[model samples]
Target chain A: MSLGEFDLIARHFTRPARRSPLGVGDDCALIAPAPGMQLAVSSDMLVEGRHFLSTVAPERLGHKALAVNLSDLAACGAKPLAYTLALALPRADDTFLAGLARGLHALADRHDLDLVGGDTTAGPLNLCLTIFGEVPTGAALLRSGARPGDELWVSHPLGEDEPGWLGDARLALEVFRGTPGLRVPGEAFDHLRLAMECPEPRVALGLALRGVASSAIDVSDGLLGDLQHVLRRSGPDGRPLGVVLDADALPRSPLMRAQTAALQHECLLAGGDDYELLFTAAPADHGAVRAAGQRSATGVRCIGRITAESGTTVHDRHGHRVATPWASFDHFRS
Target chain B: MSLGEFDLIARHFTRPARRSPLGVGDDCALIAPAPGMQLAVSSDMLVEGRHFLSTVAPERLGHKALAVNLSDLAACGAKPLAYTLALALPRADDTFLAGLARGLHALADRHDLDLVGGDTTAGPLNLCLTIFGEVPTGAALLRSGARPGDELWVSHPLGEDEPGWLGDARLALEVFRGTPGLRVPGEAFDHLRLAMECPEPRVALGLALRGVASSAIDVSDGLLGDLQHVLRRSGPDGRPLGVVLDADALPRSPLMRAQTAALQHECLLAGGDDYELLFTAAPADHGAVRAAGQRSATGVRCIGRITAESGTTVHDRHGHRVATPWASFDHFRS
Candidate 1:
């Protein structure tokens, strides 16, 4: 059926808002934070071809669009509230809109996020979501809170597990690209595809680490590259901090371990779209950090520690400094 | 100098937050409404060649992008707070970025709206702005509050003033398209271009309209079409409302009056991009409404009245029914 923009919104995106005072129909949605709480806001824009493959399904695209934005809120240790989605599509295709709305609302229902207010128009495919969440006053996590003596931890393992692990997306991309000398079993490839298409935001872990972790950031741009952001922002007294990551301590799955060393390093160190939480905590709070991960049902791995040195470095298993040249994905540069 | 995505943001969009607890550098920007206030949120997306012409300058494009979003807050009578900008560009062109930033910041500074957290990436040119504003609980205007016998009003004259007229954008587009038999003065065309590119949001007028206007909506998608939205939403008891608009009462500029009757009717009724406020108020509050217009230094004209009948119609100066087949601009249906 041919639907106008308003009709499409009514049929798909509109729903009764449980928390917000107003939802999709009004000129603007009204929301208020509860007493003694602050609203955390973030906006993410995803573009076709650059952020996702054209071969990706609409349902997966809708999930990933909201997932990446929620990851930002997770980094700040905020509880999801409501989100507004501004979408641009070349045309109003019924099947695509249905799948997209289904996927988006499924995740929203899981998090109890209300679809508030936004605009839809005809254009090249793009999705921009601005999410709002809440955190108690003076309790949000930040990247600048890391200290020199703190221990660096990650919410999930670097390369293990089929459900929530890094590097699977990169492996999936390589497989899609038909890279030479690479082979994977059919079941394993399906798992990798799922990992690439749908990423779980670590909201519960972030909420658990609110007071436990000193600093936090999500791994969107590769692990080492995201580490640099924390280091640059974490200086306590005007002196930038450093990191000495134990390369050998990085975890790997059976499939990842079977890959060539170069591929493994590239996927583990420089792969993007992981959505895992990389955080820091005081050495004395290491047990608390581990407990937080356990409470959230996510694994925690400590692969490095904050340092007073001015630059980040990695050491191999033989205790030698590794010469690394892999850079993180920069939208413009890449 | 060629700048990376991070550097580009730091140079152009990053600024000190005056009211927000945190700004651009953080994972999420934190904002809280004052006690007894609710946050008003709205998102608008603009894509090149659809929402705007390719011939438009970057500065004008930036200004219009925020202006359209601010207009939503105006319709809600919400005070501007801050906004997040998610931008996707084909490339990081320095000149374009500089011009766009300058224009965006200029309007933002005027409204004291903070530039909070947002994402920038590479893709087809698209701008999505999610604006946040504040209104005391139960004081915000809504489209569902109008009653029969309320007088319908507009913030500015329908078509007279060159600065904020309704049909100037349409006239400008026609001029650009080189429509045959159309002739506009050089100075008048320049003014029309300004009207089309840099719309002034009716923030002050809307703020003054609180409690005076029973229902309000911005005139973006043509006059008759937008009025239908109010009619559909304003009925107190689920029975729709109607409007009786006087055709002769619709004001026109000297240049507009010179146009053919068909072009004039289309431009004045179905023309889009006019950011003027269309509102309704009780007949007993007509004086108050006029006073608000005076206080805000904006012109308000009463051109219609709400009716209990369920369909909208227009009448000429002689009271003859005028058939209006013109439809508002719809992104999908053209």
Candidate 2:
């Protein structure tokens, strides 16, 4: 049977909120942050075709829609608390909503994040989630604290570090797009697809890095694009500093390592949607950073350092600069 | 110059948040509710062609998007605090965004509701807003507390009580669609248009009704449909109470009164987008309701009473039941 808006909400979204004072009814949901804690809130919208292909499954879409927003909280070193989802649908299909709700709830339950409230309406397919988290007052990791000599790190290795896990969702996209001269062995495709379809947000690592990381941002747009936001805002009164990225240090799967330099450079630097935590820490906190990575259960890789110079540079192992112009995803160029 | 997502945010949305610990630019915004206060949260989504018409002004769309969400907070008697906007655009156009941002900011500033944090992306046109508010513990008005002797009230009279302020946005839609035999005189068309475009959320009255109202709701869907939600959920252990709505008691504008009974019934009973506050209070609290209306600078009309019987019914002056079946707007029926 088809579901109307209210019925769909009741069936799919009306769940008990463990943390909130009230959930999923009346005019507004009620919540109270623990005293001395600040509410960390962020919102993200995912549109079909633009953010995901229609061919992608709905459950994965649900996971990803929330994942991207949670990634923001992760970038800020906040503990997941609660969220509100506002979804626009073209029609009320029960099966689609079931899968979508299941996918959303699984991740939310894993993090102990309560689904406090949201609205569902009829329109084109769109999912927007606003996640709420908590951090101690004045202790949140920000994009404005990076300084010269700060060590840049990523929560997870960008490429395949182990046989079972290959973080090549970007490459998988290229392959799906029929890019020539690309090959992946069996089951590796599944891993890559999963990485692309459902990104695991680095919330634990973020919580661990609360006091260790100086500045941070999620890699949603290309690494360079998001990193530039840190670089732009961290400047002393709008004066930007350069960053040096170690080409050899960039985590790449063995397969990616064998690709031509141009393709490898493209995937390694500008490939967006990795959803990894790219953060910076003082050089003195390297040990603490490593410990944070240990607790987070993710590899923390130091791929570069902040510099006092202008513009971003990629250096070879020999320390010679590679001449790859900066390229990051832009939502609108047309 | 066209604004990139960041540039657009910087130029338009980058305002200092007086109430929040942090505002736009961070991965997440940090808000600390006052001591003894609980956070009230709601989310709403407006897709192009669904919530609005394409020819509608961008500014109006911006205002309405946030207004509708704020109305939810008002319904719960929560004080508006902050909101996050997630916008998807086909391309980066400055004029459209400028008007949109102006409209959004104007309303945000009026309520001292900070624009906390949001995400802007490239996609089809879609806007989602998640609003945050605050209410003292145990003081929020809900939809389940009305008693059999309580009187039903609306913050504003529906029909023309005063010249130049007929809220007929839904009717304006009919006018815009060139519905035959409907003529709105002079600038009444513009007035109706504004009523539709810029809804006044009854936050003041909502705050005033915090302790006075037994139960409350915002009139978004037609009066009867939304009221049924109250009546259905307000019942003891979810048992419903019947409502006797005096048809003559419904507030109607002079123009609406001139329409045929069917059309008047359609607009008065089931017309959507009025955004007025509908509440029930103890019979003795009628004076308190009037005072709240006075403080809110809006009219308060008592149109009905709660009864021991089940289900809602429209009655004529002689106490004869009117057979107009309950109807309201539904997004999807197919």
In terms of lDDT, the poorest run of 10 residues in model 2 chain B is: B325-334
Cα lDDT tens digits for candidate 2, A162-261: 4212236678788779888776665667666776788888899999999899999988776777788888778886777779999778777776776777
Highest DockQ among the candidates is held by which one? 1
Q: What is the DockQ of candidate 1?
A: 0.61
Instruction: List per-model TM-scores for chain B.
Output: 0.94, 0.92
Q: For every candidate, what is the interface RMSD in angstroms? A: 4.3, 4.7
Which segments of model 2 are wrong by more than 4 Å? Answer: A1-5, A157-167, A326-334, B1-6, B157-167, B326-334
Q: In candidate 2, what are the lDDT values of residues B160-279, reduced to their tens digit?
A: 534322236667778888888886775667766776788888888899998999999898877777787778767786568778898777776767766777667777777778888889
The fnat of each candidate, in order, is 0.84, 0.84
Per-residue CA lDDT of candidate 1, range A69-124, in tens?
Answer: 89999999999999999999888887888889988989888898999978888888
What DockQ do you compute for every candidate structure? 0.61, 0.59
DockQ of 2: 0.59
Scanning candidate 1 chain B in windows of ten residues, the lowest lDDT window is B325-334
